[model samples]
Target chain A: MCGIAGLFLKNRALEPELGAMTAAMLSVLTSRGPDSAGFAVYGQAMPGFLKISLRGAENFDFGAMAAALDVDVSVHDDHAVIAVPLEREARVRALLVQRFPEVAVVASGARMELFKGVGQPDEVSKRFGLVGMTGSHAIGHTRMATESAVTIAGAHPFSTGADQCLVHNGSLSNHNDIRRKLIKEGMRFETQNDTEVAAGFLSWQLREGAKLDEALGAALDTLDGFYTFVVGTETGFGVLRDPVACKPAVMAETDDYVAFGSEYRAMADLPGIADAHLFEPEPARVYFWERAA
Target chain B: MRVAAAPVAVNEPVVFDLAAAGLRALNAALAGLTATTNQTVWRVKNPRGEHAIAVGVTAPVCIFVDGPVGYYCAGMNDGADITIMGNAGPGVAENMMSGFVRVTGDASQAAGASAHGGLLVIEGNASARCGISMKGVDIVVKGFVGHMSAFMAQSGNLVVLGDAGEALGDSLYEARIFVRGRVASLGADCEERPMTDEAAAILAGLLRRADARAEVGDFKVYGSARKLYNFHVDHAGHY
Candidate 1:
């Protein structure tokens, strides 16, 4: 069983506390998943630039790549977030492919920075300084690795589209069939994880001009299996569960924030939780809350 | 002359703080009790969604859990009266042999799955598969129940005071379902049967026992059509 926790702040005043709140929510769910943990934070966006989260090989020279790419890079453990001009994204990716072949672009967007690693949730959260992070929203996952290997590449909070991230708590039965169809549609995958296929499916739909909600609606018809998926986009936070909905999911919402957890204990200590509206997300329905862009 | 207040039977409840103690200890304490144990009242504090709060109890006791609970709160229960003051996770009273379990708040999927006997009551709505494969157990939901409820149920009665989701009873076997509100859709071989005098009496009894506020005449009864019981070759598509 995997655990998924997410926080979306409607009140910008809570942005500075997003990481701490999300970390606490994810920590209580360690028993649900203890092998690996991952998270994606959507912080402030810089005008005319994009923040690309990248992971490199052991002892990789990030400073040299920064010098060659001529971008602002902040190193954090084995991962770094590089700020590049929006126009230069293609050229920078090409250069990284040519020179720094060992560096993988984990996620690229205006505001989102994704980080994940193989370890206990506390260790992984500390490694990425998740408690001190400041963001408008965040999605976290701790995986027990049922159908895949326990590696960083197989961790969750997979971001296949810019500023869009997804974490799943249940397995997909027909991911391979969908994966083959997506590969034929020109979607490249970095791992054989079924969740990657789901993320890629959503990304493909969004790229095909479907709105976020529409993409999720399309997923209900195409994907088969038990799943409670929490997703984050540029301006929205959403949840979708399969028709069967065996996977446990509880949600709490108040004027301050909207939170999702695999279980209620994961959300019991959140701010204003005592007065929040708590309920379970229904089956085969898409629930989305968006911030005014 | 004013009568003195009847001597208050203050048997201070045996409190078990889940936050301060381990789950094993709490279960062991409950397990230690027999039918005639004097410690008949228990109060579980800070449940905080912990699982298996009071499972496999043979003692005739009353347990009041103060907060929400995780999966299988009262699994395999026998002769214990368990109540949750807050919501319950999946399989709240799963496989209960005989006892009484009630949830004051909503319950997740498979609330009383495959229970052999006893009465399970939910004051709030229950998610999918409310009483799947129930055998001789009685479930009364004051609110709605989700899809596939009472699926393949062999015997017993399920009463829902609110609406029911899709596939109310798929592949049923002699289990009776009574719903007060609309049914989204019925499952294969499950059909609405005209309420008879016996069925009405049964519904009345369950509502009286559950203390539910609903008219007995405003309900519909559903049970297996028995077409798929033997699995004829013509019914292969259903298989």
Candidate 2:
């Protein structure tokens, strides 16, 4: 079983503590999934600049790579974030494809920074300095690798749309069929993992002008097999479970925040959790919360 | 003649603070007990949704967990009285042999699943597959039970005081179900049957034992149709 956790803070006062709280939630769920871990943090957005999270192979010279691109970069373990003007994103993508073929673009958004790795959840979070991150909201995942290989690409928080990511807990049976259909529709994929297909499906729907909830509602018909998906978007968080709902999920909401976990243990440490309103998500229903822009 | 002072009675209930003591220590202590154990009362504090609390115990003792618990709480229990003061994760009292398990709050999926002998009382709602494959356990839910409950159950009874979700008691055996509220739909080979006097008595006894307050007349009994017990060419469409 894989574990999924998320925190959406209504109180900006708690923004600085988002990473610490999310790290604690993920750490508590390590026993459910120990193969790999990943997370997406949505912090304050900088005007006129898009943050691009990039991953590379071991010992890649990110500083020199940034200098060559004439951009500023901050390097984490096996990953880096570069700030590029909005107009130059296409040019940077072309350059990375031609010159820095070893680098992989993990995600691109104004506020979201995504990181993932193949290791214990705690080790992966620490490698990315997860506790020090300040964000408005965050989503995390720990993987047990049932349907795919234990690689970073197979990890969760898959982002196919800008500033939009999803973490899944169960396997999809008809992903190959869906993947073929999406490829014919001009969507790209990175791994054989089924979760990536789900992300691509949502991205395609969003591109076609379906709102997040509408995309999720459409997913209930197209996707088959077990799934409990927790998605993070530019301004919202959404949850959905399959109609059969074999997978476990618990959610807690308080005045300060709303939290989701694969199990109650993941959310037991949240502030004022004892008084929080806790409930399991109903089957085949889409629940979404968004902040005003 | 000097009589040895009575062995100091460990009268105070033993408080196992999960905040300080690990789960292994708690289960080890419970497992070490014998039928003749004098330490009959155990209080677990600050459970913090820990998994496998008080599992595989054979002694006849009373365990009170102060907060929510993770999966498989009191599983395979034998001759123990376990009570969870808060919500329970999946598989509460799973495969219990003989005992009494009670949850004061809502229970996740598969509550009392496949328990052979016991009495499980849930004061709040029970999620999907509650009492699935139950053998001899008597489960009483004060609130609604989710879909596919009592699926393929072999024996025993499931009493729901509130509505039941889709497909109640699908493909069941001798297991009897009594629902005082609406059933969304019946599963394959499972159908509602008129409550006989004997069935009413059984339901009354269970409600009393579980400390539930309900009118036996309000319940609708359900059981297997027995048509699927043996496969035949005529039933191939159902298969």
Candidate 3:
């Protein structure tokens, strides 16, 4: 099980202050996924994107890949930031596919970003500026490798396409079955993480014109075993608790904000939280929180 | 309304008279003290392993039991903090509302049973039936808990940093049970669920709050299978 957190601020600007809030919230949950920590910050100007961690190949050239795609790429100690042209994202994606196919595209967006690595929360925060950036909505993961190898790529908030990412906490018994189906549909995989298969499954449904909630519901139906996943997109976020509701998930929402975590303490540090009521998502229920159009 | 009274200052040596006091009296004396002012620290020099030493106090008082305590030492407690320096008997801090209850030594059955709120931090092992029927409470056990923990739990959080016994969370409701170590067996109507974003967030938050080092990915999720929610002939095996 890994710790996942996301905050969607309605009528609130995700600036430095909000970034600090996210950092504080994630800091309290450091023990959940001490292996790695990653987050995505959404903003107005940036095309939302997911940022993922990459290790083992220290000599990998991110600048060349960015230049090839005509986008700016910044490399940190354990992560890299890619800025994509929203209108020409498909073209850039083709370039990414052509080059550096080994490097997994974790998540993306003008505002959507994802970063993950192997270490404690403090280490990941220092490497990724997890506590420094700000956005109206953000999602994070702290992973403890279960079924997959404990590599940086296996960390969560995995993305299949631009502005589409997912973080999960339980295993899918039918991962291979789902993966086989997804692979047939042209979904490529970078790691052997079962969560990646789930990401592809959700994306495939969404690509078929299903709403985010409907797609997640279908994924839940198709997937077997204990799982609770949260999918984030450019416009909104969706949360699903499996039929058994085995994993722990608490949601506290108001008119202006919706905060969800495995425990209430993660939200204890959020600003403007006077009194927070906690409720678990009903079994097999798909809950969606969208930024008003 | 019998009340047991004991008065002692911080770092003061005191002897409790449990022979003359019942559970309600012990709680009254504890509740009457001012915890925030730090005027409520009492040391039990000769604890006779009595039951319900300090249950249901809203103050931030700290009571240190020098020796072992009997059942329900801090049941349904609110704010008063109690730490048993030695081992404890059954049902310590059952249905705790708030504050911190720590047991330095091992606890018998039903520690923090049905706790509605508060943080119950047990440094040592807790025996069977921990957090059973809990509602909205958070329990962090550094060691193992016995069988049927969180049984029929409606709401709250149970974090077992160590291993868990058989049939955990049998017929559970909405409570979230996170075990860092092994689970001997899952209870009836309990099935593993896919970990969602909300669950990941909640688990991560709990680890941080409990200061536990267990990773979210290393744990497994377990809850009711929903087949017995209303009970049907097709799912009669669960009964």
Quality of model 3 by C-alpha lDDT? 0.73
From the highest lDDT down, the ranking of the candidates is 2, 1, 3
lDDT of 2 by residue, B1-239 (tens): 01112232454467788878789888888898889877788889999999999999999999999999999999999999999998999999999999999999999999999999999999999999999999999999999999999999999999999999999999999999999999999998999888999999999999999999999999999999998898889867865
Q: Score the docking of each candidate (DockQ).
A: 0.67, 0.75, 0.04
State which candidate has the highest DockQ: 2
The local lDDT score (0 to 100) that residue A75 gets in candidate 2 is 92
TM score of chain A per candidate: 0.98, 0.99, 0.87
Clashing pairs in 1: none
- What would the per-residue lDDT of candidate 1 be over residues A100-199, giving only the tens digit for each residue? 9989999989899999998989888998899999989999999999879999989998989899899999999999999999999999888899999999
Candidate with maximal TM-score: 2
Kindly list the per-residue Cα lDDT of model 1 for residues B9-71, writing each as its tens digit.
335577778888778888988898878777788889888888898999999999999988999
Question: Between candidates 1 and 3, which one is better according to DockQ?
Answer: 1
Chain B vs. true chain B: TM-score for each candidate?
0.94, 0.95, 0.83
Q: Write model 3 residue lDDT over B1-239, tens digit each, in one string.
A: 22223344554534455545444555666667664554566555445455667777777767777656666887777887788876666678887888778887676667777788878877777766788888888888888887788899888878888899889999999887888789989897777778878887888887787677778998777777776578588757856
Global lDDT of each candidate: 0.91, 0.93, 0.73
What fraction of the native interface does candidate 1 get right in terms of contacts? 0.60
Candidate 1 CAPRI-style tier: medium
Worst 10 residues of 1 chain A by lDDT: A269-278
